[model samples]
Target: MNILIVHAHPEAQSFTTALKSTAQQSFEQQGHQVEISDLYMMKFNPVASQDDFTELNQPEYFNYALEQRNALKQNHLAADIEIEIEKVKRADLVIFTFPLYWTSVPAILKGWIDRVFVSGLFYGGKRFYNHGGMAGKKAMLCFTLGGRDYMFGENSIHGPIEQYLSPIQRGTLAYAGFEVLPPFIAYHVPYISQKDRQDILVDFEKYLKHLDELQPLKFPVLENFDEKMQPLN
Candidate 1:
């Protein structure tokens, strides 16, 4: 299967980078083709603006969604966005690797989502959730965090880890129609020993090797809702 890894850490030697490398090697060992988008190395611009379009749809009032749809139809999207879209189109699975920042994805990665998951390309109209533009694709997250695993559970200070990740998993990936996988998280990486870190890498390899056998997170189907988007009785 074709796989795309979107890596968003600034430091090459960081634990997050190690996880990215581990995933690449593991997938390749299983004979899967892999591609990586190293955002920092590529100097990917994370901000969205009028500059993203070759020409504006409404020059008087800039509505990003309107401009994006127009640009996509005109084949006038920004070069970088076009490239990213092509990568997503080719990949059967897309993995995101980053360090947790402020209880969410790094700004660069979030911007990547905003810019690349464009209207008329990734999602629009009734094409969302199970019927989204990217319906058959899969997405997973691999991240490292400074906090201990226990700290993120229901009875802990930070609450459930899934709560912190719901925005990305459900709002972003699921909304785009990706079959989201359970995340592989390396908790307290900075506080762990080198041996522990290596062990984590080994475990990550095992996870990748068994990726095909893993079940995706469950989500509601479009049929579950009525035209107004309320759950049908």
Candidate 2:
């Protein structure tokens, strides 16, 4: 399988980077292709604006979605976005590796989503959820957190980790039609011992090796909702 690892950590020696490397090595050992989009290393522009398009449908006023659709049709999307899109398109699976910041993804990763998951290309209208443009692909998140595992449960201070990741898992990945997998999280990496960190890496490699056998997270199918997007009940 072709895998794309979109890495968002700033430091090369960070634990998050090690997770990415582990994934790559594991996949390669299994005879699968791997590609990395090191966002910070590439200095990827996270800000989405009119500059992303070569020719605007309405040059006077800039509407990002409208321009994206226009640019996609004209094959005039920005070089970086186009390149990223191709990477996603060619991949059978896409893994996002990053550090959890403020219960969300980093700004650069968020911006990468904004720019690369373009309208008319990734999703639009009723083409979301199970019917999304990227329906056949798979996506997973591998992230490190500052908080311990117990701090993020239902009765814990941070609520549930699922809640924190719902936006990316359901709204973004699922909406785009990728079969979402359970995330591999490393909690309190900064405070953890080297042995614990190594154990996490070992676990991550095992996860990659068995990715195909893992059951994807269940999501509401488009058929469950009406034209108004209300549950059919």
TM of each candidate vs. truth: 0.95, 0.95
The segments of candidate 1 whose C-alpha lies over 4 angstroms from its true place after superposition are 224-233
Write the residue-wise lDDT of candidate 2 on 1-233 in tens digits. 99999999999999999999999999988999999999999999999998899888899988898889889989879999999999999999999999999989999999999999998868876668897889999999999999988898889998999999999999999999999999999999999899999999988888777877899999988675465853211
All candidates' lDDT scores?
A: 0.92, 0.92
Model 1, range 64-153, lDDT digits (tens) per residue?
987888899988899999999999999999999999999999999999999999986677777689987899999999999999988888
In model 2, what are the clashing residue pairs, if there are any? none
RMSD of each: 3.2, 3.3
